[model samples]
Each structure stands twice: as structure tokens, then as C-alpha cells.
Target: MKLFNRFPAIIHHDDSTTAPSLDASLPARKWETILFSTVLIWTFLGLCFPMYDTDFWWHLKTGQSILAGNGIPGLDLYTFTDADKPWIDLHWGFQVLVAILYAIGGVPLVTLVKAGVVTAAVAIGWRACGNELPAWKKSLVWIFPIICIAGRGNERPEMLSQLFLAMWLWIAWRSEKQPDWMWWLPVLQIIWVNCHALFVLGLIVGFSYAVDAVIRTRWGGRFGLEPRTDGPPLGAVFVVAVLVALACLINPYFEEGALFPLTLYRKFSVEKEFYRQNIGEFRPPIDFVMQFGLSNLFVISELIVWLVTAASFVWLLVKKGRWSPYRLILFAGYSHLAWQASRNTNIFALVSAVIACQNFAAAEVIRSVSVAGSTAGDRPHQTGKRVKLAQGMTGLFVILTGLVVSGVWNQIGEKNKPFGLGEAPNWFIHDAAKFAGRDGFPMRAFVAHIGQAEVYVYHNGPLRKVFMDARLEVCTQQTFELYNGILAAMAAGDPIWQNLFREGEPPVVILDSRSSRPAINGMLQNPTWRLVFADKTGAVFLHIDTATRLSLPPVDPSPLMYPDGEPKEKSRGK
Candidate 1:
């Protein structure tokens, strides 16, 4: 009888011992569930959208060129004026990948591939957040990726770098407990450094982790509550850092490619057009709320992060009595990045969500313990209610999923319609086909050939070099200036249209009958250029100086006499 009475107390102690182990397992399970959800959501969102950026044209053209035997062009080949200027393809690898996909599948397949990559990136970021945070806090990380996808809504290089950044952070965090894992850091850094210039961020994150390790060793280890270290041997971080830095030089242009971002930064700062114009990425974050017409969602999300951080700080003060230097550093870093640009809202959102989730998980564990103590008398009834509640929540989730799927299908259909997204004419495709075919055709033949050439190029022109294509960035400053100037002058009804007829113009200018009214009028009036071909789509102008002279009337020596001009009297008509 004495042993049986003592058995209850012994069993209770055993249960208490296993409770923490179970609690630890719950967080891991919760994190996995959240990460899976994030990937599915991001993939669905990406698949619902199409490539809508102006940069996509250049990406496609560059990819197409890479697919051909030309390899990466070291000189500007898009225009007659700057064909020999040295060219540096910063995005050559990305372009070549896209081109290979295009060759194998088509435009739609490329879109799907981009969407899939973005989905994977978001999944990686989501996993990092869950790994770093407590179970309840993981859900908070989901909101940021949601807002970021809605804001940017395109597959770009930054998306790829974001995944690498997340992976770096996760590895660095894990390295605190398993120093042997430090080797993977350099390898990841090497891949990231070559993939995008954003690889510089990996170095910064590594440095931060090293600083954190030093702080934790000096102060955190003394506190008794700090996590036990199984970190790598001495000088491991420095060696990895050096290796990662050197790994950046393995790109196509080597040092030039690695240092290209500095040049781009300088150009962006100095260029009036880029700085003065409203570029989507450069725009302030608050502006996105207005542009997208979101009702304080951005502000609310930001405040939620700040509020949770403040609460976490207070909780640390009351409970642990001191802040973890590493956490404080991360908080400050994210805060700075968030405030620097509106686009950085995503970064802030992810950081804040992770912190919030950690806090929530800690609070929930406390609540579960408190509830268990209070409800000890009614444990059996409480367990039954909890199981019913879980079932109800699952059913609710299923209903919501159905609604979201229906809405997404409708949205995808509306957004993917043909010509729903505007198509800019492929000037390079037209020009390349015209000049490469024959010596030179009449104006009409040139226009027909260029139009027909666009069709042929669309089908088979990958084998040939193009004069100009839709890849706007590959265009030299002179070519862009001339193209813009010609369009502007045409729009303003300027009389300087004869400049295009001067020696060495693009052999054939494809003039759409409806869109090229000004160019048509200019070609008709210019004495040195003649319209040798015309069709329903466009008219072609050829520089036939002799034929142009024969078509023009003789010049008169008399002053105040208009050449080929006959004065018409003003007439009054009813």
C-alpha cells in the first residue's frame, strides 16, 4: 500500500521530465508545417503572374544570343555607330540560363521556370525564419513573404540572392552549435558570390556571425544560460571568409565581373534619367501603399514588427534580466535596412516575423503550463475539447483553400491573356533580317522584308547576328540617345528629320503605317531618302541619293523662290 501511494508521485515526476522534450519537438514540427505552407503559397502566386518588366526583353535577347554560336558579345553589336565599343554582360549567366530554357520549351515554359525558382527562394527564406524562431513565431514570417510577392511580383536576380541570404543566415546560426559545419559557409558564399553581386551581403552576414560568436564567448558563455558551443577550431571563420572572398573571382569576366556592381552604382548615381525617373525598385516604400492602394497594410505590418520587438526587449529585461548581444545586433541591422528604403520592407518584415514568432512560442508554452495546472481537475474533458477544436480548424482551412484556389484561377486567366500585356516591336530582329539577306532592297521591299524577317527571326533568326533587339540595356548610350531623339523630334514635329538620312543610317527603318506617321511624313519630304517599298503593316525608306535627286525638282537661283513650290491662293469655301 505504501509503494502504490509513492508510485503516483514517481509517475508525476517522470511526466514532468518528458514534458520539455515533447515541447522541444513541437516547435520543430510547427516550423516544418509553416515552411511547407509558405512554399505552396509563393509557388501559386508566382504561377499566376507573367513576366511584366521592361528588363525581360533584354533578358530574352541576351539569352537568345547566348544560345547561338556568338557566345557572350564583348562589343556592342546592336547599332551601326557603337559596334566596336567594349561591352560587359553583368547578367550573362542569368541570360544564358533563360535562353536555354526558351530554346527547349518556349516563352511560357520560361515563365513557369522563373516562377518555380522564386517559389523555391521563398521556401528557403521561410525555412530560415522558422529555424531561427520559436514555433509560434514562425507563422509571423509568412506575412512578409506575402507582402513582398504582392509588391515586387516578378522573377528577378534579387529574388535569387534573397534565397542565398536566407541560407547563409541559417547556416551561420546553426554554426553556433556545430562549428564543423563552418566549411559549408565558404561553399555557399562561393556560389552566391558568383551568382549575383548581392553575394557581398553574405560576407557582411558572416562577419556579423563572427562578431556574435566573439561576444557570446566572452559574455554569453559566462552567463550560464547561453547555448553550449561545439564551434569549429581556431581561425576557422577567418579562413572561410578569405576563401569566400576569393571565390567571387571565378566568374566570366573574373575581377571585372566581381567589381562590376561598383561601376553600376556610380552610373546609377550620376545618370539623370535613372535617378530622376520613377523606377519601381528605387521608389520609397510608403509609395507602394499608395501605388497598390493597400489600406495601411504596410504600416500595420511594420508596426507589428516594431511592437513585437519592443515587447521582446521588455520580456528579456523582466525574465532573463539582460539582452542577448547577438539578437540586439540582428534587430538593429534589420531596423537600419528597413528604414533605408521602402523596398526593404520585405527584409524588415521577415526579421520582425521571426522575432514575433519566437516570443509567441515562448508565451504559448507558459500558457500551456499555466492552463495545465489550473485544469488539472478537468484534464480528461479539456483534452477532448482540444481535439474537437483541432478538427474544426482543419475543416476551416480546407474551405479557405477552396476559395483561394477559385480566386487564383480567375486572376491567372485575366492576367495571362494574349496582348493583354503590351508588346514593344523588336527593332533589332527586324533590322538584322533586312541587312543580312541581300545587298539592299527598295524602300517597299525593305519594309516587307523586315516585317517578314521579324517572323523568320521569331522562328529561325537565332543563328544570325542582330543589329538591335529588344534588349534595351545592351544598347549603347549613343544608340539610345539617337533613338530617343528621333522619337522626340518626330513627336515635336521638328524639321531636323534629315539627320536620319545622313551617311550611315540603319539600312532600313521599319515604319508601322499607324505608329510611324511622323517617320512616314519625314521620309516623303527628305530629298536624299526615298520610299522604295510599302505594305499594310509599314513602309520602308531607302537612301537612294541619285533616284531621290531625279524625283526632286530643280533648285532655282531666284531668292525668295521655294524650290518645287507653286503658290496657291487662299480660297473661301462654304
Candidate 2:
């Protein structure tokens, strides 16, 4: 408040006004309320798709397997191609939780779980940014970093990591002098290790804090509060860090749990060159900046974070004449992670709040620079600051209102509102029911794209054993390569495609006639597969063996069914 008062003049009146007028003080409190509401509203935007995050399918199935009394998946079970391969189901706990939610209320429950986690994350983050002061700086730090993280906040186990990140930050920053409360750090790590591969983030935070505490104890009186306990603070900090690492091994995978994040990082980084092109989130922030223009919201958010980080460093340099090594490391480590892959932006977001909050809460009025006195002249400036705060609150209200209205008003108008998940807008849902027929399907097969796969699962379309669904990780590297190989071969009129199909032929195949034109063409060219059904959204190709058993009318196969017999320039399309 004093630092804010240094902005020329404001919030100081008569030098003895113990508490300022409600009008002068209410805006700060109201602005905090506004920020809390904004975080909730924005957190929900993550579930803007009815069947968001196709990966949820495998997670669901994995959860079911765990509930089925099978041990947490220690080996690959979903893919037919990977019988010998070991699979690391790192997020087994999260999978079971969401699966239970889904079983109870279906998609609505899943959506709620996602919104609930992200909302909790943002809420915890708000506190981590500091309850001691709710300045525009904290709001800026909270709002902009959230925008960066929300890009990948979907219905995935990673959402659990995000929540854990916020909690870790909160507990970590608060445990500086309150060493008695540090025992919870290991408990949190145990849950984190079972919940997501990002458990390493918790370890990193614990280590950073432990080291920072040791340095502070050495410096004495420089890093805020003294250890509340009689013993040195380093003992508590070291105990917490060591136990956090040890707690990670409690998962079913044991040592694998300890090394899970390293393996996952290796999984992504080994094929880093390929993922940068294929995975949108793996693309660097600079790539987004180049492709999406400066005015793009994502880019703008990135810029805000980078600017604030740079400003924080500059502020530290000016005040202390040298970089506080720990602060610089915290900012640089997360910022670099975020810069490298867009998905890790959540790390930067939650950590930014911690860094800002911890710094703000620790900072003392530099006795050399702070004005020790405020005169009667400061009275008029209070009104100006109050007005500015009011404007900030009003702006927050307007933004929140716009989002709520945009999301809710779409019921009868344009039904596909982006602000939140709405009912499935495509006609495929209604159409697929008619095609599946009253009689049960003997088995379930593969659907090429996620939207189509979602439609299949939603309507209970059958043939069994999908080649792969939204859960990309459920498939082995060999299987994924083979699946794409089949699609490419079918599209390119390669004879090897038929040979590939002969290797692992599904009784039924569902694909988009437009986007999967090449695949459809290849299927039709084969006498073994017959086009038994068609619709605007997609078509179903029944193998010759199953075509006789199914009662649906079989359409004659033709090359002319698709435009130029080529896949759309954009593989997945409207």
C-alpha cells in the first residue's frame, strides 16, 4: 500500500486516517473479487468441447481397468499391436477419479471435473500471487499468465498436474518460516507422482525452496522471517525435499514412478524434431508469434509474461545491484520450459504467481527510497487512485459479463459457442443412430479422426477393437506409424496398403468420404471391403465378411464418390 501510495499521491489522507474511506478502499477489495470471478469464468473455457481432449478415452479405459481389480496399468493393454510392450500409466489416480465421475454423470461430470480443477488452480494461484496486496501488478500477473496456460487446459490428467502445481507453489511459498507445515510436501508429492508425469515439478519446487532457505539462513535477516523453530531452517527444508523425492516411489511402478517424468520427457524430446511439426503444443512460442501475428491473444499473453519477467529481473537488479540467483533461476527455468513447448505454459503461470507473491510479501519499503511522510496534500490524489481502481473493476466486470453472455446466449442462436462446452452441433449424432441399426454390431472397429471417433463412442457405434481413438498414447509407436501408413497407402493407391490391411484387417471401418477420400478410395478398390453406409458427416465401410451379416443397405463402391479422389488439403476439416 505504501509503495502504491508512492505513485505521486493516493490512498493517504490526513496522515492519520487509520483506514481510508470505503470508496477509497473498496475498489482494491472489489478488484480482488473481480479477479477471482474472472479466473472461474475463464477456467471453464477449458471445457468448451462436449468431448474435449480425445485422450480422455484411453484415460477412461485405463481407469476402468484399475477399477476392474487389475493393478494400475504397468504394461500396454489397449493396443492390439503392443502386447509385449510395457506402458507407464503415470496418471492412474487421475484416470480413476475422472472415470468415476464419468460413470456417474457421463460427459457433464467430466466437464465439471475439468472446470473444477482449473478453477481451483486459478483460485489457488490468485492467493499465491498474494493476499497481502491485490495491486494491478498482481492482477496483471494472474490474468495474463492464465491466458497462456489455458491454451492447453483440457480434460486430461495434465489438468491434475496444474492443480498440484498451484498447491505446491502455495505450500512452498508459505512454508518459508512455518517449517512445521512442511511435512505435507511429501504427501502432496506422493499424490502428484501417482497423478501425473509432472510430479517432477513438485520436486523442483521443493529443492529450490530448500536451497533458498539454506542461503537465507546463512545470510541472516535478508530473506524475510527467521526460522520459527529452534533448529536451523535447513534441516526442515532438507527433510521436506528428501521425503518428497522418496514419496514419489510409493506408486505401483515404484522406481518407474521416480523416473516417470524423465522417461516422458525423453519420449517427447527424442523425436523433438518431428513433434515440433506434428504436435501444435510442442511448437515454440516464437513459432506462434511468427505465425499468429502480434495482435493474437496467445502471442499478446506471451509478450505480457516475458515483459513482466524481464521487469521483475530489472527491478531486482536495480534494488540489489545483482540477480538474486534463486529468483532468476525460478523464472528462467519455467520461462524456458514454456518457450520451448507451449503446453508447459501452465508451469510458468502458476510459478509466476508464486514468484510475484513471495517477492511482494517479502519486500520491505527500501528505507533509503521510501517517503516517510505524507501530508495533507496527499488527500486529493486518493480520489484519483480510487477512480482508477473503480475503472479497473468496471473493466473486469464488463469482460466477465461479455464471456457469460456469449457462452449462454448461444442456446438458440449460433449453437457452437466457443466460450464453454455446448451440445454437439453436428448432425452426425442424429445421423449415426439411424445408420448403426437396431440390431447390435458384432464388433467395433477403427474411426480415422477424433470427431468421428467421438461420434462413434457417443452413439455406441459398433464392431470392436478400435485401431486407435483419441488416446494417442494408448497406441505404440509402431502402431501409430502403421495406422498412418495404412491411411497414406490407401490414399496413394499403393498395393502395399492392401498388404498392410491384410496384416490387421478390421471387420468394419468408418471414415469421412471427403477428408479420407484416399483411404475410402483404397477401401472401395478392394473387393474385400464394401461401402455399407454413407452420410454427410461420414461413411462406414464393412468388410466383405461382415457385410453379409449386417442388414444395412450396401452402397456400390465407386472412385467418383469423392472429389478428385484426393484427401482435403487440411486432413481434418469442417
Candidate 3:
């Protein structure tokens, strides 16, 4: 009886002991339908897209290697520059998962899987906001987050981390009703640690909840906060938090894997300015503001959402006279992350959306405005008019949502390829990679773009290696600097660039024509390098001597030249 009383869900069989479910408190069935319909629309918007992430191919390649008897690689194998560097492949599980999905149904299936994970994560965040808020309002607020997350919703393992974080938050918020759900967190953490470095977020959230519960247990009314009677016991929360921390060490690299996020975190600092400046995603939102001067709608939208979220925090504290320690901590932490790097905006958007809803609910400022209900004393005519307006607005919103998800609105000013399956045109140098994998081509080449390197390795890894890829964790600063130096020197038409190449660096060079145009033009003017292959996707260049030895014909430059013709000063300083 004592055990059953303490943990009724574990051993109790009697209906009398069962607590009311979290859903029991929800307002109406129509709102549930509305919420789900909105979610479905949001999810469809994500699914109707081709693979656009540049780093996705390498992750898939790593998974294939793992399944092909490589296990979790202790050293980098894809890069010639960092072949012997220690690699703590925390993305092994995510890689293996996508690899299996790819094997089953190819790129389309992987795209579907990525969409599913992101939708689940977003849905869970919606659920964590609870059911008291009006579904229409929730739907409206949800659009902001959906837009914010859309920028970083590429096919990446961070999607898995987002899912795990949502699950953790859901479990924490519902601990009072389903205390047993807290136990599932540590189990998820074990998988999370193996999948992505962001598993550390799980521990931070768990400890925040644990610490908040502990503080509230005795001092709930202190600091003008309302007393809470519904949360789980302090001991239970703390115990699970400890278990969650311990689960981090269950990965292949153990402590090293668990601590890998710290290493990634350090990169956001000023010391890694090269990475911060060179990597588009790593650059801060302020940099975009400075460069584009409020002309960027994406960055402006994110800032508006950030301000709204901050306002909600202040509103909850001042108007409600209550504060959630966990939420405050989350706001502080994620705010820093979002400000530090643009890629983290997705996470902050989700967090801000949930926290805003929770704050409004706790403040009792927002009431459930059900489409089906009105107060008893209200005039029938007024109620009828109000209901009709709500219905009309909702119907219109649904229609617009349908049009947007159908890729109608998406067609306007979209940078990505039109909605479809398989890889985007700009995603890879497919034909070039295939050409490089042939018999006469060099086994190693200078891949100028990091995104293109992922493609090259995916098509011809193990048998062929790149100068570098997207694995910045394994690739040292010196190698990255050297890569930049070579490109800079090559663009200047300097002979010194030849000396910057490593001793065994291949005579072949691969570059995305769109991104490395200057280098391409410079190489075109150089008598030493011959353009062996040229196409819309990318161009392949080889040393004049190597091209002669292989009997490969150099491509004509007339077709690749600009409309105005080739620049008069092709060589900067020959």
C-alpha cells in the first residue's frame, strides 16, 4: 500500500487511485481539431522540399561506413588533411538512422523521415504549452515559430536533438499528472548522447526543473511567486536529473562524447572568429542586420519574436507576480545561443513560443475563446455574429494555409529549389563527383567549398579522400587557414599558392562555379591549370601536365564565360 501510494502508476490497479489525464482539462473537441489541422499544415510545408543541406551527404556517408564494419570511427577517414585526427562521432546514431532510411527508399524517404522528426518536435512543443490557451491564438503564435524554425530546418541531426528536448520539456511540465514519464528521459538521453552533441541540453533542462522543484518545495511563495501544489516531489525530480546526467556517459566515447558539446560551445566565442565569419550559419544575426540593414525579413522576424518573448517574460513576472525558474533559465541560455549564432534561432523560436504561451496562461490574461461557446448571459444575436466571424476567419486561415503548404506562397522569392524529392541542384556537384570517381582521375583533390566536399566524399569516399570536409571538430585551425590561404592566393594568380599545398596534395581541383567564380576565372587564365570538366553544377580543373598524361581534353572557356565576355584582366598579378 505504501509503495502503491507513493507511485500509484507503477503498481496501482484501482481506478480510484488514477489521476486525471492532462487532456481531461482541455476546453473543447473543436479546438483540438483546429490545433491538429494547423500542425498538419505546418508539417506538410516541411515535407514538400528537396534535400538542401550541404552537410547531410557526409553524415549519410559516415552512417554507411559504420554499417559497413567501421563501427564508430575513432579517427577521421574522409579527409586527407585530418585523416589521423581524433573524431568523437556523436552523430553516429543519427547517421545510421538516415543511412537505413536511405537504403530503404533513397533520398525521398530520408526527406520524409527528417520532416517527421521536425514535426514531432514542433508538435510536442505545442503540447507543452498546455490546452488552456485558445487554439486559434496558439495557431497564430505557432506561425512565428514555424517561420523561425524553417530557416534552420534542414536535414540534420540537430532535428533529433530538438525532438529530445521537446520530450524532456513535455515530461517536466506534465510530471504532476504523469510522474512515471520522468523516467523515460534518462533512456532518451542515452540515445541522444549517441546521436548528437546537443544531448547536453537534456541534462541542463532536467537539472533546471529539478532545482526549480527543490526551491519551490519550501519557498514557493517567496519572491512574490504563487505557491504550487501540483508539481512532482523534489526528491523524485532531483533523482531523475542525476540519472539523466549519468545517461550521457553511455555513448561509445563515454565522458568524451558527453563533453563534446562544450567543445562546440567554445567555437561560438570570439577566439573562433574565423569559423564564425567564414561559416554562414555560425555568423550572428547582428552581422546580418549590419550587412543588409533591416532589409532581411528573416532576421527582422526573428528579432520581433525575440522581443515578444522577452516581453512575455516580463509580463509573467510583473503582472502575474510569479516566475518559473526553469523558464527564466531557458530564456537566458537560449537567448545567448541565438544571439551568438544564427543556426540556433530554431531552438530559440521553439522555446520562446512555448514560454510565451505558458506565461500568458499563468498570468490568466488569455481566456479560451472556443468557437463553439459563449457566456450564458450573452445575447443570442451577438453570440451568433461572434461565432460566425470566428468561423469565417478560421476558414479563411485554413484556405491560406493550404495555399502556402501547396508551395504556392513558397514560389514567391524562394531561394531553394521548387518543391520535390531528391537533392537540390545547388546542393551538390553530382556530375563532377561522379566524374572524379572514374579510373583516370586523381584519388585526392582540393575541394574548395565545404558543402561540395560533403558531396565528393559521399560519391567516392574510402577509395578517394578530400582535402577537407565539414567535420570542423576533427579538422584543425591550421588546415582551415591553409585552405583559405590557397584559395586567396589562387584568386590573386600568385605562384606562392603552389607552395601552400600539402606535399601529397592532388594536381586536381574541384570548385562550385557559383561560389568559387573568382578562383575559376583565375585558374582559367593560369597556363598551369586546365579546366578538364565544366558544367552548371561545378567545374573540375587539373594540372596542365596531369591533363596531358591522362589524355583528357580541356573544356572550352567560351561557353562558361559571362554574357559581357571574359574579364580583360583575368590574371590579377601574373
Please name the candidate that would achieve the greatest TM-score relative to the true structure.
3
- List, in order, the clash count of every candidate structure: 10, 5, 0
Error of 1 at 550 (Å): 18
Q: Using TM-score as the measure, name the better of candidate 2 and candidate 3.
A: 3
Of 1 and 3, the candidate ahead on lDDT is: 3
The digit string of per-residue lDDT tens for model 1 on 34-60 reads: 444644554444344445444554555
Please identify model 3 stretches exceeding 4 Å from their true place.
Answer: 1-28, 365-375, 378-393, 405-408, 411-414, 501-505, 558-574
- Sorted on TM-score, highest at the top, how do the candidates line up? 3, 2, 1
The count of backbone overlaps in candidate 3 is 0
lDDT for each residue of candidate 3 in 1-574, tens digit (9 for 90 to 100): 1111233354344331222222222233444455556665655565557787888989999999989987888988888778888899999999999999999999888887777788888888887877665555566667667767766767899889888888878777777566766877778899899999988877767767776777777688998655668766666676777788899899999898888998888877754588877888889999989888876646876897788778777888888788888787888888888999998888888878888777776775543554346454443554344344445546755775675656674564245634567877444788888887788788887887878888888899967998877787888778888888888877888868776454653547888876788888888878888898877667888887778888988887553454233466764532
lDDT of 2 by residue, 214-311 (tens): 66567644443343333225655665577787898988879966886775565456765655765577777778788866756656776787777667
Better of 1 and 3 by TM-score: 3
Go through the candidates in order and give each one's C-alpha lDDT: 0.50, 0.61, 0.75
Query: Which pairs, if any, clash in model 1?
Result: 58-471, 137-357, 179-232, 285-342, 428-468, 443-532, 443-533, 444-532, 444-533, 444-534
The Cα error of candidate 2 at residue 561, in Å, is 10
The all-Cα superposition gives candidate 1 an RMSD in Å to the true structure of: 12.2
* Candidate 3 residue 567 C-alpha distance from true site, Å: 18
